[model samples]
Target: MIKMALMALRKLAEVILAAFTFGIVVAIISSAPAEPTDPAIWSFEDTFLFVFVYSPIFFLFIGIPASIFIEGIMKKINLRNCVYTHLVHFILYVSAGSLLGTMVALFFIAEGFEVYIVVWSTIAALCFYVALIGLNKIIQFSKEHDEE
Candidate 1:
């Protein structure tokens, strides 16, 4: 039982580290000044004048984690050892991101934050698809590499 506990803890650590990676990237991007000329980049990365205003939340909640998860799956490390670890990580991200977006949107709604829910939801979907494809590629590469 102790061994199982330790492995679970390790998986948790991986998730936390991945989340942190995404949080850092989001933070850096959020801190930068807005560039209004671009179409979609503006929404998440300084679409509004106050994008930086939400910088802390973006980094702490979203950026670091995502990157970590992406890196882990890409490297093909823990998937074999910790069954369901990947699924759990995927759930954690999608749930966490949605939760954050919903909470923030609520706060904004009070202050007249005029972003559409559909737009933010699309962002969530995009994140999911991107991760899915990337992981698939990693799996494909791993198979090819091992065949030799």
Candidate 2:
């Protein structure tokens, strides 16, 4: 049971780290100066706060619950460990990101919604996916090492 708890903690860490990375990459890449002499819209401090602080909060509210629901469904179907599951997750993340980003952008932006939303959302999805996968691999390696 302790081992299970440890693993859960690790997974939680993985999620938060991935979310932070995604936030940072998205914030940096999408940042732009509003005027020739003006500061970038997403300033360094804003990015830091958004990436390091708000990300975990958003992940708790949005990511964890969604992951739990999806994980339950995946476990039910016995596909949690299948090789194709990663691909499915990648596709799902991209699709959901695109849809949600587009909707939110549409509400706030009247022009150029297509470019920023679609591109950034896709990039964000990719960042999250890659970060999670890389972190999971590291966790798995450490677990194996501990067992040895």
Candidate 3:
């Protein structure tokens, strides 16, 4: 029920991650591109920057606060809750990102618009990072309150 720049950011980050995961999970699992230097590959300009750059960066944005919330949901002094939250966060992220990505992909498919993996990844990474930090900070502050 939260309506703030933070929630909007979380929603956006989740959507982007879901979409990218939808696009790249298939690529990463099936093709197994080893290196950008590998000439035999199908160009990972999109994959690397998107998956590696954006996804991990999202950890800082969505992941940290997500970790805190998961901890709250778990409601225990155990570290397991933290781990569980991270796993759930990642899964949620993929789910949302994939849905958005699929819709976009369909657009690309119909219009024959080339998906610039490089461009998409680059933008997602840049935008999502700011959102991630905001979320984690909220979690951290809340955690302190919980401790007191």
For candidate 3, list the clashing residue pairs, or say none.
17-97, 18-96, 18-97, 18-98, 19-97, 19-98, 46-117, 46-118, 61-132, 61-133
Instruction: Give Cα-based local distance difference scores for all models.
Output: 0.50, 0.67, 0.51
Q: lDDT (0-100) at residue 138 of candidate 2?
A: 87
Winning model by lDDT:
2
lDDT of 3 by residue, 24-94 (tens): 65355446444656666555455545455546554455444544464455455343576666565455444
TM-score of each: 0.35, 0.65, 0.33
Q: Estimate, for each residue in 88-112, the C-alpha lDDT of model 1 and write its tens digit.
A: 5666556556665666677757765
Estimate the overall C-alpha local distance difference test score of candidate 2: 0.67
Q: Rank the candidate models, highest lDDT first.
A: 2, 3, 1
Number of clashing residue pairs, candidate 3: 10
Tell me, what's the RMSD of every candidate? 10.0, 4.5, 10.2
1-148 in candidate 2: lDDT tens per residue?
9998975786588667767787778667656564436543666557656776755665555555555555565567665566778767777667756765777688868775666766765665566567667887887899899999
Clashing pairs in 2: none
- TM-score computed on alpha carbons, candidate 2: 0.65
**How big is the positional error of residue 9 in model 2, measured in Å on the Cα after superposition?**
2.4
Q: Is candidate 2 or candidate 3 better by lDDT?
A: 2
